[model samples]
Target chain A: MQNKLHYEFEHQAMATQFSIQIVGEEYEDAETASMLCFQRLDALELVLSRFVPDSDISRINRMKSGDELLLDFETWDVLKKAIAIHQKTDGAFDIGVAEYVDVFRATKQGILSDFEMVNALQSVFKKAQNASIYVDPETPKIYCVQEGMTFDLGAIGKGFALDQLSELLEELSIKNYVINAGNSSVLAKGVSKNASCWSFPISSAREEFAVQLNNSAVSATGTFFQGDHIFDPRIGQNICNSMYERVWVSSQSAALSDAYSTACFLLEKEQFNELLQNNSEIAWIAISENGKIQFFTQKNIPLAQYLIS
Target chain B: MLAGTGLVLANPFTASASVLSANDKVNVAIVGCGGRGSGMIFNNIPKIPSANLVAVCDIVESRREKARDRFYTLFDKKIKAYENFYEMLEKENLDAVVLATPDFWHMQHSVDAMEAGLHVYCEKAMSNKLEDAKKMAQVMKKTGKLLQIGRQRRSNDRYRFTHQILLEREKMFGRLTHAMGQWNRSKIWTMKPNKQDKIDISKLKQYGFDTVDQVYNWRNYTKLGGGVVSDLGSHQIDIFNWFLGSYPHTIYATGNNSYFNFEQADTMATILEYDTPNGPAIGIYENISNSRAIGVYERFIGDNGAFIISEGKDNKIYRESRVKSDVWQKYIDAGYISNMADMKKYKAKQSGDSGIMETAPQISYNINEMRDMDKVYNLPAHTAHLYNFIESVRGEETLNYDAETSYKSEVCIYKIHEAINAGGAKVTIDPLEYIV
Candidate 1:
């Protein structure tokens, strides 16, 4: 058996940091693969980043009702995935929450008074909920049937990009790799030389355990970074409850892992079980305020037991 | 000041003051009204209250006309527009002229403007051809006119703070040993000539352009521009030289147009050797046309720390773990640096929960706070560069990057260009060659 070396590269994108680690016989090939992966990530960011004035998402946000615009294939595919997830999550995961984000940001910055912030947030929520955003996946054309609809892909853009990175790496014939978007989301492929399966830790106050992941992605979501900034579209307000401290989801698809992790943070236990019943590929672990853990998948029962122990 | 060997110091502002009065508004004219030129017209000139834009000149008629109308509409002042630069130089009583023309025309326009008794602010990669670039410097020396090269990073507040305070004063990153910079961008620089913006072929040929696209997107061709190396690499490489305080001794480069299929090489990487005062160091730079992945930034690594600095918000400083934490704590206390994972700013209630264990302490400077401070204290990069020129013309400040200093970096850039064109050849630059 040949011992493989690992190479890693770190870069900043989507207003956060991302890293790629690959195990290969040669470092140069791994470096090249990493560069190519970052290129795909950059292209995705140019289309998806709301900060870019001319990005497709930004252009869509600025469009009036009845305006039809052409979107890139990548943008169209991501939106299709987003719409499907929105349906699966029963509208718990909405991309049209950018308006609420803007209002919250304004209020935090003291740009809007409390009365104005409430009125503005309520107005934007109503518009966004009622706004008809039409997407033709075949033609990749988007029509804004109603105005005041804005999209913020912050929750899922990184995972979507990581999936693209995986595709690029696979195209290059590089098999063993682990790509991480910040510490919140990760995609792992193949096992390391020393281990039979790639292992990641699931930690809580009372205990910590290692879950072996192979050809899979894991995404964790919490109020750890910005504190209750994740707005629940159903409530038309941010999630301030401390009951759900953190939620982690593992799936073969990074996009699904990211979306479900976010949805699980707000979903009831029975609701999450229902979601898992329909989508058996996903495995989830959620931690509550009292350091209690709950597991919702039997994909790898031994690994789950190893983790819980 | 002259040396014993009769070498003039190449200081263009030492002779005499041309625009002396504090109250006098410096009359300025733009020599090129294309992308960068028009940027200066709309963005830079409007920000400088002491400078008045008096005329606009370009070979393209529509560009000059639009520039004229833009200035008129924005400032409510009538400015003259001309196709011939000499005609504009002859008519306008300009104290300074901003040369945003193509690399091939930089020498002719800057030399002419200086000989016409006006100060000059010429854009970077001073010229495509080395001889023309040298002559621009020589003319500045002979004519005794202030010539400021548009290496706008010299005027950037963050860069200045990094060089002056962090590196020089505080010795933040000790014994700088290596520097690397990259400018990766997608293939979108090519310009398609709009029907309304098209120029007659005869007029284009008169300006030495064979096609309208060539006239608009000059940087893509070798005859009119210096390709990606000179167009993009020059900016970052200049920073390497500036911060290192030394010229590169040797250069080896490799580039190809395999991806973009453009006339010039679309991707290039160069390794530069330098002997700084501390010791010998290496500089590596690459510009890729197919990937805007890492975006653009320059990193300086040392024994104790490293910093990633750019005009963009992707600026950061990191301290090596071997160094004592207390050494950097003073900088953090003094607000020179900040923790990369800033937990204090997060409003989340801290649980004793250990969610994930980090492998290492990711320490990074608080660039956002620094940038916000920059907004209150400093002008934007482009406006600051132009304002520096205007101030130097008015005898308020000396030129930041005089022609001679800029020519030295251009010499190294042209060598890298030569090596890349020769297919990964290594070029040795003599110390004497840098003395323009």
Candidate 2:
């Protein structure tokens, strides 16, 4: 019989396929751990997914002005991360821009006139720009000061789930594992079967780079899935012209990597260096309009490194 | 704080706070301190302003202490922790206790809490044994105190709307004919103990657990829990009873340890015969252990229309093609159902031949709750269930699923288990078995 040292389990959640690959453990043990982890992921979706009707995000969307709603700790943890990233990215990564995002999606179906798309953007621009949501640092309490702040966590939820799963892996005492969500987000911890770091390829239209990752996450963000147009919620402008063809970001947590990659797509070339400097631990790669790929990483980062090209 | 005891004093109903009057709030303590119990403490209780958490109890000392510490870390509030149940009841002046223990412990814990003059909200499949479940319900009637079972969907906004408005008042699905539900998990495996937990073997045996694996995965064992039928079927099967307003008179079930040698059925299917007010309807339910196909949901079919709903993301309303669009147009106007994507119009738009709306081509509709209903239940299902119980404790509203009503579903559930064990024999039930 061939020896089996690794077990793989796949779960679908948050509109993306998630996978857990555990190594150096018995098949049944790894399978059970993965099942329990998937159970946690499913539980998180019940509280986090917007389409679930009774999710905390859905409840938050139905909140009125001055509503002080307490949230699930998991939901609160994600929202707290989202709000912080919203500030760090200077509003390029905003969940409140869902109304604007929906319009762009609608324009893709070929039913809406160009004029209608433009009009829709201008109308919700004010709401998206002025949207404010606050969280109590002491508790997972949301203070909704503005009404009708629609949110879609499509940008960061998968990464958040991966981050939570990594912690679960540590608790399960599984020393080595790799988790991938939707093929866009990946989190790695410990080592692989061969004792090297877990590795995956990050690619764009013209080039690909193999990344060695452990105890960190790498997230690739692009607009090729639904539509090419992405709105920079800060100015409510469709940055499809200026948006990068692809962006990849690596950080200590997938939640950060996911948010920053999406945010990096809307950033100007000059803003990249400063944002990288501000977040010294984070590294990124961006494919510009011309298909030229740029890579950046801080010194002393060993695990999450790409061959500089 | 209780003098000489580790338990915290439960705030009396007259205790006032910053937000609501003390009279409006109910002092609640949670037992179990496990996964579901932690969810109640963090996900549900915090959202209900009228439910004040006073203490937590668990047979596992570390679990209770960890829950207490986690609570203080998250909310900046202190809560008492205890390892013994009777000690907690003797010390904390609680108005209610939320029990999220193993199925075998539910009856004893719930009955004790009710006898102590405290309202109780216990998780479902009331007990592993049918008789134990009936005993808990009987105590609920004898004590005259509130006892709400945690069949949370009974309080879900979407579910309640489907039952109260679409099915009952509007008769949206005329003459319910059939119902189906499934919980398709990929694998049935035993749980591994959390390495971080400090398990005390001697303490565990007092609660009928001799190993950490048993405590972590009680539902996988027959002696401690009701197996897959309790873990998953209890929730979805309860939905059928609630929507149909009657119990199944006959059950035919088949299952085997196809993949695992666990005591419970690894893969099981049951056919329930329900005599509904509409007519005699058949309900089919299944739990698959080796494959996660088609996911989990409850589908209710009738002559006029059928709708599939779940606590997860599988909720959609479908109309029979023969029924004209105008028949559901009023439901859309009433906010009971909305956004029907007529395939004819959708395909026409897809081909650029019409100005009609473009959507996926299906006789599918997106069901919606009324804006007013949305406002009232802007909380998680468990939070809504817990809120309903707290409200009942405060005399503001009655329970969504009291113990006596939930026992009806448990009666059907245990019968399904029996049929599975008897090699899929057809078992007939007397209607009197459903009543406590």
Candidate 3:
């Protein structure tokens, strides 16, 4: 019953709560754009959901043999972006560990022999070596020759979804909006009611905060708070247990931030700094298991921007 | 004549394929079974429409098996996998291929894919070698294929929006003159060869590396990956080109591997000169590895203000303007002002020209501050690159930031590297050389 043309909306999707602030002349348009974002996200979930056994991705997994496989454009887009990050990170940040991840689950559940599970995990990693796949830009075809090669987009799916939602909002001519998925990944389109850039604390408990956005993108990464379920396929261990418990990254895109934060957590301080040096828009706040928070900022942001006062 | 083998457009002047009225489903392929390839397959999962996962290729059987199993367990999507990129490219009737292989493999894979009648979205730096960069451009022209370098920033709305503001907006910076960009980093993990390994280490010997760790961490070394300069500098330096409105005329550079002790320069500083249509310009780009001192950032200094951009962080503006003082008055009287009346004739000039002494308002803004103006000015025309790519496939608007625009950014990056190598020697760039 709000009479204002602009409105704020939030929902839970992709295992994270996402919210959008839409401002436009027509209230319905803002709401419609916000509504479309959720609908699109739901549609994306239908294809990418790991839990959906009959999803498009699941169908590809069930295929026995095919030289050329067709997918919904959404699925193809996610796969292409994931492939790009996988190559850039050099396998440090991989989504192909679904098998090992599943095996890791099976071993924990006592459903498989520990030795057999180890062998299976090793096999998965072994076959992962020669998986050369490409997405053709002309016909928009996805091609793969190696048998047993599957693509997963977990790490970057939410970012892509956010990007889609942002596009929908823009098409509706909605500006002055902020898209936040959980507390980790966010995209801000315009300034808030206040003249200041959209600002948020790295943590609610601490007064120290970072500028969440400036008509750019921001993404946060950490293992699920409740458990150590997120596993690194690289060494077959829980990433949360091995490295910083929580890492938050602010960038120009939620996808890059999401990727960098996850990748940075796996890297030592030095590698993270090197990454920061390369991408100037990335500002970071990392909290290790010991409850130590390290703050990093690039040249573009001044110390004052993050200050609430 | 045909460019090569990819596109068979009835008209090449427009470059854009004829629009399809209804949403069109594009079939896509994934090349390389490694992390990047698989990652790309998954990330774009929800955006485009009517895409086929069709194929996956990798050299190793084990890696392919893992991919297949994961696809089944996660999405149950069945895909054909192959060992060789060529076999897959030849066999798969793909419209596009996302080349997510290692940097060294980009040029060959892209050329082959184009010749095989597929468009390409190859990963960054355009090529691992300088020769490959030129060859990639040539192959694209010959094949008439759509080639998008993996410099995703070109597709980013924020960058597009900002670049537009810097280039088209008047009174934005009021004649930008100087700028600086830095990619400072800390130490990176140097992988050591494991004594006992599961994978073959023999291939490592061919590359002069002892083990898989060295191969995996090739970015830290020089042989396979483009050290920090190419790996990181290419991105930020590309930003310099985007903001400066033109490529530099001269460049100079100095670098050291003091921290990483790697073969190539890990830390480097470069200077570039650009002559804007309006005025002369200069920029400094620094890539540091020892410490994340300034992190990564770019600063655009103009006569009236400065713009700051950083990845993952906020884009900000710090304001500064010319201040009038007694020294300024004397300088203005002496000869600084080209069209000035005699200083000896006017005592008011000795004190201060009240008009010249006025302080201009601060000229700076963050993305948030521009909404009111954005709506009024209708700025940021290129903010819809992604949607455009999607719609173009769906027969909506034509694709913006095509191969030519992307190549423009790469040309600037390559010139920076060349300049750095020549001790920051100034190099003139002919824009036509990069345009197909």
lDDT of 1 by residue, B1-436 (tens): 1112110112222232212122578999988887678768865776576788889898877778878996776556788999988887778888999999889889988898889899999998799999998999999999999999999888876777777777777787889999999998856355444324537778888788888778867888888999888888988999999888799999999999898777889989999999998899999999888776778889999999998887654667888989897888787677656563233222222322323332323445543233223222145566778888898898977887899999999999999988988989989999999987
lDDT of 3: 0.59
Pairwise lDDT winner, candidates 2 and 3: 2
Error of 2 at B295 (Å): 0.7
Candidate 3, residues A225-299, lDDT tens digits: the string is: 636555665565554455665777666767777776666666666666566676565665455445666666665
Please write out the lDDT profile of model 2 over residues B83-107, one tens digit for every residue: 8889999999899999999999999
Candidate number with the higher TM-score (1 or 3): 1
**1 versus 2: better lDDT goes to:** 2
lDDT score for residue B307 of model 2: 87
Higher-DockQ candidate of 1 and 2: 2
Predicted candidate 1 versus true structure: per-residue lDDT over A1-309, tens digit per residue? 357687788867788889988785376567656765675676578678876533678667767766766555567778888888888888777777877787776455544545556677677766665677777644445766667668899888998998989986775678888889988889989866666557778777765667777788998888777686567887787655645777889888888889888888888877866887778767655555467666677544544443523
Best by TM-score: 2
For candidate 2, lDDT tens digit of each residue in A1-309?
134397788888777799999888887678878977898998988888878888888777766656767678787788877877777788788777666665665555544445566766776765544544556665556766556467888888989989888887886788789999988999998777765568777676676767778678889877678468666777877765655777888887998899888888888877877787788657654553556567766645443345432
Docking verdict class for candidate 1: incorrect
The backbone clash count of each candidate, in order, is 0, 0, 138
What residue runs in model 3 are displaced by over 4 Å at the alpha carbon?
A: A1-309, B1-23, B33-35, B60-68, B191-198, B201-214, B220-223, B319-364, B369-403, B406-436
Q: What is the lDDT of residue B257 in candidate 3?
A: 66
**Candidate 3's error at A74, in angstroms?**
16
- Candidates in descending TM-score order: 2, 1, 3
